[model samples]
Target: MNKKILIVEDNKTLAKLIAKKLQSALGLTVDVAYSMAEAKLFIARYTYFIALLDINLPDAPNGEIVDFVTEKNIRTIILSGNIDKEFRKKILKKNIIDYVNKSGVDDINYIIHAIQRLQNNAKHKVLVVDDSRVFRKQMQTMLENLFFQVISVAHGEEAIGMLKSQPDISLVLTDYNMPVMDGLELVIEIRKTYTKNELCILVLSSNEDEEITALFLKHGANDYVKKPFSKEEFSCRINNSIEALENIQMITNYANRDYLTGLYNRRYFFDTINEYIDEVKNSGEKFAIAMIDIDHFKNINDTYGHDTGDKIIIALADILRSSTNPHDIVARFGGEEFCVVLKNINQYSAEEIFNRLREEVEKFSYHLKDDKYINFTVSIGATLFNEEESLEENINAADMLLYNAKKNGRNQVVFQA
Candidate 1:
């Protein structure tokens, strides 16, 4: 339950400093081991999110510690005094997250940054497309070391199929030459469905042709790497691309989400619902739209205060989020009013889902000062959409039903029946 980091360095002073910084800056539990034997003991006792290891330990001077820790499946970033080209390449081939030279303060800073980056990497998924089974497996292992969920395919066509199946995939690493579809064609096709900000593409090639690299970049690739790249260079490029995409996504998300509860804003909800309708029009799939409002929300505001009311609204938002499918859209229409769009469902199923949510809200008791407590309820109105109907008509019908639910009773779901 506790997030911890292990530091394995013979230099006591340096080890203490690193542990201090990790504890103070990141609030992680830090354990320091001065030798390979000690490090193994720590590894056996506690699970670590990551480990920082000095290559030349007293007990294991030939970088045996790297193999020992990595074999345990703990993510590692190696610290080394030697930066020889061959030595670095050999270290990288071992599938460590990264290897940093122990030079100065900048190196320590890089370690800190790498730790943060790996933490963020847990939320991302990367797709690796290579024709060679050996190359694909190698890449998957490297990516897994960096704490990313990897989906690998043999060729570009399978890569596209994977992308369609997993829309949340954040990065694509593709080989230039393949059987079914080549990398260049794959990048061009991917760009058609996903924009530059939504997905990042990295091309790997043995081709020395300058024009090929330029062409891939011109088309849609975010970065290009030569086949024989050092582990440092490969990890750095991948991290840079993913970081840039995440920054852009953060800004775009803020624009689309409500400022209060972090749910989709009203405008985004409308736009997405229209897109959803367009998507299902030819398939003859049914969907439902629901409008939900907190019952007597103003009374809660008057009794407890606006702060408590906001908490209640946020609580209800959490309920809606947990109750619906990921494909279903839940948004804050405004104030105490919320909206949800249920996909691939009829009026009956939608009613069942919303009624369950209503029961959850009723069961939750909000605590106040001096052991005081209060309960809240929500009224929901929903309607199934017909292919002949428009978005506005469905919303209006749902809204009218919601109004009727509030009028008839405080806590209930009102639909066709």
Candidate 2:
């Protein structure tokens, strides 16, 4: 089912506007409730991913709806016209995702952004490191409220271990003062492995020293949050940092991936394989490089048309991706041709893998349209790498083997014994 949202605001105009924007921008199904009773009925009928509640409803004037939705375990963000500092503080203390003052267009835009951030948060893991157990727990709760998977450690040492074990962690929130290692030292050490684009580090400190903040940023911290930060400011900073990282990642992915097949492009394959070769050279490990080509690809394109040929190529790419191990590097070399690097594998294992893949492709059938179908197969040529040989030499060997495979017959695995 599509994720749905609920907007409970007595102002019919503003509520519908918010709903419309959400529907158009995020493709979310939004249900608008003009009163607390209507919202209750909607809540009972369908599960909502999040709800935007007004502080003063006709029936629940004192933000009673916040409690009602929270009781259902639905995430809540308040859209109230009240900008009173004490009231905002009180509402923020209630463990809501965010409390937006519905006073202007910018605030509504903020609400939209917060929702987007929340959606992205589900894909990220955050690590919170602090010597104070209370602060660590507090930050963890806040991060969790933003829909992030949060792990809290009591000190910087533990944080380092966590990062080592959980390489998927996207953000680290650490305190300045800690036992064993401080946040600054942790940032310095983390920078040794991960760049700012790869991992986001945010420093949280009560210290008012400018040099301290500068030091953290100079070392590698992406941003800093003062200890007594407001809920809105904290949420904004965290989201901004995460969003920036995501943008960088998206650009990197576009650069590395083939536009059509979504596999690593030829350039990326060479770049990555060079590094892999270097690592293998140091470890004295054997690897295999395979060059794959679809058999009779030009004939298929000339007979069935280029569109159908494209479909066949896509189907074959899917097979290559699924048939290989996760650690293997798969790439689209160009039209109807592909390459893969199988790490720590001998010639025997490489042959077995490619033969299995060829069998699967030969057995598989492709449907073009209603009552129309086509079938295709692949020819593979692979070579086990010798650390002493150059990359160009290994590639040439694989290409020669591939040519021989085509010369003998199609749908075969050719490799050096």
Candidate 3:
């Protein structure tokens, strides 16, 4: 489908010219609006992929149109003739995707480039935490306009719940002044739970004092946007922050995930288990550890090539990942073996889970190079942690039970007493 672009220029001649040029040059359907009212009407009627906005429209001066465009979140380029540093700074301060000084020649190319970049870039998800319905809705509209998936919560507590539930959230935009836990308090709480590498947070405040901004940044805020910001400026800042987060996440994934099976690597698994152990020690919550091995895996690898063995491992990883909860830690434990750690699970529930997983593996099938397919089962040993016992003792008990399960039968679940 052809992408849509909205041109919000008050000059009838300029609007028509830009609209025609964009339509002819890029094959975009360009909607021309001469006033903010007309622009709002257009926006209400049709969703544009990108919007070219003039900040100084007759109806709303001081770039009110920028706010409206941002609230709508369509990728925006500000075409402003006002070159004053303060005015430019203010206009660029909100979530406008780009700013083009209209005074220059052939700067229309900048809008084209900005639109192209926005289209090619990945759509990011932002969680907006604010108690104000008006602000939440406003931010939601703006983010959606830019093709971002937005999850909005009315309060900081709700935001925490959202973050815990959705680990794939790309960024968080939180209002600093809110009821039911203020922004700074929320940031500290979230930081305690999720490391800086796991999540990125940005604080929004009406108070723009340098000292206050510094404080917010110190308390794990990736960035801060003062209230009454420009749409173009806000977009630039948001993009910058998201880019930084993407780089960090890429590095983190490389360091923490296993390459072949796409499961948590040994180091990450140990780090996570240690954290769980600490929590269990403090809170007396139950936890369970399981050791799993594909039955006759070595024979299969010897019969078929190692490539086929690798495929089987990858398939098993997929099955395990699908069977467990996101909070459960699953890891490739070298060779053809895997491990699962379920936090807050009692002995009975842990045995049941191990049995289910074992049954699933027995029923799972895989295909090889010549359309040759094979089915296999897994043997599992599980042990629940008793607060009286040490972490290593629990793991060792599980491992011993696993060996017994393999000895008794190739595909079964064994639980230690």
- Which whole-number lDDT from 0 to 100 does residue 220 have in model 2? 93
lDDT scores of the candidates, listed in order = 0.90, 0.90, 0.82
Best by TM-score: 2
lDDT of 2 at 331: 97
The sequence of per-residue lDDT tens digits that candidate 1 reaches over residues 1-417 is 338999999999999998888887787889999999999899888999998999998899999999899899888888889979888888878858877899988888878888888888988999999989999898888888888899999988898889988999999999998998999999999999999999999999999999999999999999999988877788889999999999999999999999989999999998888888888889978888889999999999998899999999889999999999999999999999999988999767888898899999999998888998989999999888856767887788889999999999779988863
- Cα-based TM-score, every candidate: 0.88, 0.93, 0.64
Q: Candidate 2: minimum summed lDDT over ten consecutive residues — where?
A: 276-285
Query: Which pairs, if any, clash in model 1?
Result: none
What's the true lDDT of residue 119 in model 1? 85
Supply the global lDDT for candidate 2. Answer: 0.90
Q: Please, what are the lDDT tens digits per residue for candidate 2 over residues 96-196?
A: 98877788778777778878889889999999999998888889878888899999998878988999999999999999988899999999999999999
For residue 312, give model 3's deviation from the true position in Å: 0.4
TM-score of candidate 1 versus the correct structure, residues matched by position = 0.88
lDDT of 3 at 249: 83
Error of 2 at 320 (Å): 0.7
